[model samples]
Target chain A: MITEGRAWKFGDNIDTDVIIPARYLVTTDTKELGKHCMEGVDAGFSKKVRPGDMIVTGENFGCGSSREHAPMAIKGAGIACVVAESFARIFFRNALNMGLAIFEVPGISGGIQDGDRVSVKHDTGEIIDHTNGRRFFAAPLPPFMQEIIKAGGLMPHVLRKIRG
Target chain B: MGQTITEKILAAHAGRDVVVPGEIINVRIDIALANDITAPIAIELLEAANIPSVFDREKIVLVPDHYVPNKDSRSAEQVQIMRRFARKHDIRYFFELGEMGIEHALLPEQGLVLPGDVVIGADSHTCTYGALGAFATGVGSTDIAAAMITGETWFKVPESIKFTYKGKPQKWVTGKDLILYTIGDIGVAGARYKAMEFDGEAIEALPMADRMTMANMAIEAGAKSGIIAPDQVTVDYVSRRAKRAFELYVSDSDAAYVDSKSYDVSEIEPQVAFPYLPENTRPVSGAGTVPIDQVVIGSCTNGRIDDLRLAARVLKGQTIDRNVRLIVIPATPTVYRQAMAEGLLETFLAAGGIVSPPTCGPCLGGFMGVLGPGERAVATTNRNFVGRMGHPTSEVYLTNPAVAAASAVLGRIGSPEEL
Candidate 1:
């Protein structure tokens, strides 16, 4: 699973309230949530973000609230993946459960600027900044987590397990 | 190797003699909880998976406290979904509006959780049960669905951070102040993916309500859980309300920790978190006269009977500023009844405050007391993220009940000493 995209950068502590505010939480429809994604922080985010764009952020991205809407919205918006310096624990798990690929690369945000073309090799955990010809490595996901993501999130993974 | 309290609890649940940090393991769950907001989504996922039945209906607890009284057709529909799922699964602990409180506060009071149990909830503040010496944490709706199907979930044993407090608290300084100070000291992500073990003489001496307040906000620091060893105080608190036997586990004296910090409580002052970030804290004396339009005192953080008594003591005879609107909500119906019986509700009403039912209404901007553009509020609820209460332009200051009451009277940030 390799992903190639341009980067959209944000700062630290980008909370769930800013990702998709509680006002839009009336429904669990991922597409509707994607329409309002990042509107709290950047009003034009939904309109401007293109499919296959990657989000890069400073430390502690996705903090506050255990709502899966934040990651679900990001995934539904056609964003390929999120690379952060760190993540709030629940957000990290939620992203995995929703099959939204996320990677933790310390100092990764400092090296890449917004709109920089980048490619990620999920299997090898290699991040390549095409704009600058620089490469960074993130720890590979564990075998079981990789399988869960491949199965398209937890529900599918569990269903497959039960069927087997 | 000596095991930390968190390791001990997780190992016990995993049916292992020992476990270490950073190792992924599957553990049996004792209690699984979901509120109105998360339960609907979990139920949807469960139906999508085509699972015939829940692993154990008796172990699941559902509560609809987020947008209770049917704020809108959508929220009402959400609650209906949870109700249908509860009935379909024969869930034993389904709580309706009248019987419900905030899940965090209600679970321990009803004795559904016990010491050394592994608890999980779809809401982030589920870590609040760690106050009872349980290995509790929060997960997402899909994870909750998986747990509903299998009665077990996976976890990575987290590294532990030890916080030791000494001496005694000063007047008007409470658990709220201590937690604010700790979050300020360690930035919002300081304890990411780690277990926070709170110890020291001052912490143990704190009452159960205050300890609950401290443990409730551990998620604010990005901690997986916050815990205190069960002592005589825990035993006394649990024996009165608990229905069944429970196991108690303590950390070995030689247990290892990733990091440690200590503070003297006597030297600490009342604290507050500024707008948009729980980590942006300042001593109350230096908080200045930041005017406020509203003051809220409720939520799982500090919405107990004792928290109400503290606010009532500050607002006994004085009225709030005409420009200010004070909203005081008890966490549960039982807490509401106790406050009314103790005259706390009457005191709030007499002081120009509005007392509402036991709902999480204003805390998460669901309804009841949402702020308008450019309005500012001082609240006792956890999390002060931008637009948490209402408009993106509106601001919230996080503090304790006493400070919220005093600020309501002054129409600005102030302390009980000013009264």
Candidate 2:
């Protein structure tokens, strides 16, 4: 699978609170969550983000809270994927479980500027910086996770198992 | 190759002889826990998946702690889903308002989580159970949804880091301070994706509440779990409450570790983590007297009975500073009742502090005591991140219950010795 999009960069320690604050946690609806996405960090994130636009960020992309609302907000805002130097483990699991594309590319943040074009190949862990014409590698995804994401996240994966 | 306690627990659950770090394993969990905030989404996922029923109703536990007492209609609706789902599923452990406490505190108090158990929750601080020597960690709601059906989930076994705490703690120091000092030594992400195994003279000497406090903030250090090998203290604490049989897995002396550190507990003072991150810590004596608007002494991290008693000892016979509005919240109804029975609530009330019901309350800035713009608070709760306790411009200073109580008396971030 290939994801191509412009990059919206964030800095380090971008916590779940800023991605979507607790005050908004009363509702878990993705679209409603998207409408206020990153309002704590960037007041205009929801309005500015476009479908297929990737969020490229520095280390610890989703630190703090286990609220899946953070990633749901990003996916709901129509972002194609998130590429980071690293990710907080829970957020990494949450994104994949929800079928959101995420790439852990070491030093990927240094290569892509905000709004630069980027492409990611999920099959091979290859990331092509279309804007800068540079290519980088991401840590390979485990095959089991690949299966879950292929089935549109863990829900369908479980359904397949339970119904089997 | 010898395996750490975490590895051993995972290996036993996965039916493997031994497991190494960074390998993936799917283990059958003993306890699958969730709260109102995460469980609603999980229930929705299970309903969406059309999985007729859960794998083992007895293994699944639900608690409505966040926004519980249902702050508003929307929050009430979210909890209503858990209430209905539990009824339909015949879930054995559904803790409503009176029976509820913060999930982390409640589970331990009731002996629902025990040593050698593989526990997962949809909430981040699920790692708190690690203090009981359980292989526990936080997961996303979808994981909970799937685990509800299969009683299993996957993990990329984390490398282990051992921290050795030596020397006796200072008079005012507690588990919160030790964890804070450790977080300061290791930056927020320093131990990311690893198990923090704590031990040594000081840790072994601490009480179950303190051990739970240290393990609770393992998440703040970005650790997968914070654990202490169970001993007599752990055994004595659980024996009274735990009705189920349990195992106590200890780390092999030869177990390999990725990193290790030794701290002299006596050298560490009651610490305070300044605003924006729990890693930015300083000794309370050197905290420079930053005036505060409120003092909150509660939350899963420090809302246990021990924490309340420490705070009450400081607040007794002392009037609250006119400038500070102190809010004391016991983590669970049990702690609340214990504190009430012991007259700790009276001490707080006499000191001009208000006692709230056992809800997370303003710990997440969710009500009870939300800060106004530019207001600053001294809190015993974990995480002093931006807007954590209220308005964006408002600030939070994290410390133990003692320092929190003393700060309320001094009307600033100060030490108990100052009183």
Q: CA lDDT, every prediction?
A: 0.91, 0.91
CA error at residue B287 for candidate 2, angstroms: 0.8
Compute DockQ for each candidate against the true complex.
0.84, 0.83
lDDT of 1 by residue, B1-419 (tens): 79998999999889999998999999999999998888888999888767799999889999998999779999999999999999988999999988899888899888898899899999999989888888899998988999999899999999999999999999989989999999999989989999999999999998888888998999999999999899988888898888777999999999999999999999888898998899999989999989999999999999998899999999999999999999999998899999999999999999999998888888888899999999999999998898999999999999999999999999899998987
On DockQ, the candidate that comes out on top is 1
Q: Over 4 Å off in model 2, which ranges?
A: none
Those runs of model 1 whose alpha carbons end farther than 4 Å from true positions after fitting are none
Worst 10 residues of 2 chain B by lDDT: B44-53
Q: In lDDT terms, how accurate is model 2?
A: 0.91
lDDT string, candidate 2, B101-195, tens digits: 98899999999999999999999999999999998999999999999989999999999999999999999999999999999999888889999
In model 1 chain B, where is the ten-residue run with the lowest total lDDT? Answer: B43-52
* Residue A81 error, candidate 1, Å: 0.8
Candidate 2 C-alpha lDDT tens digits along A1-164: 78788899999878887788788889888999998888777888888876678889999889898999989999888888888999999999999999888899889878889888888887787888888899999898888888888888888887777677
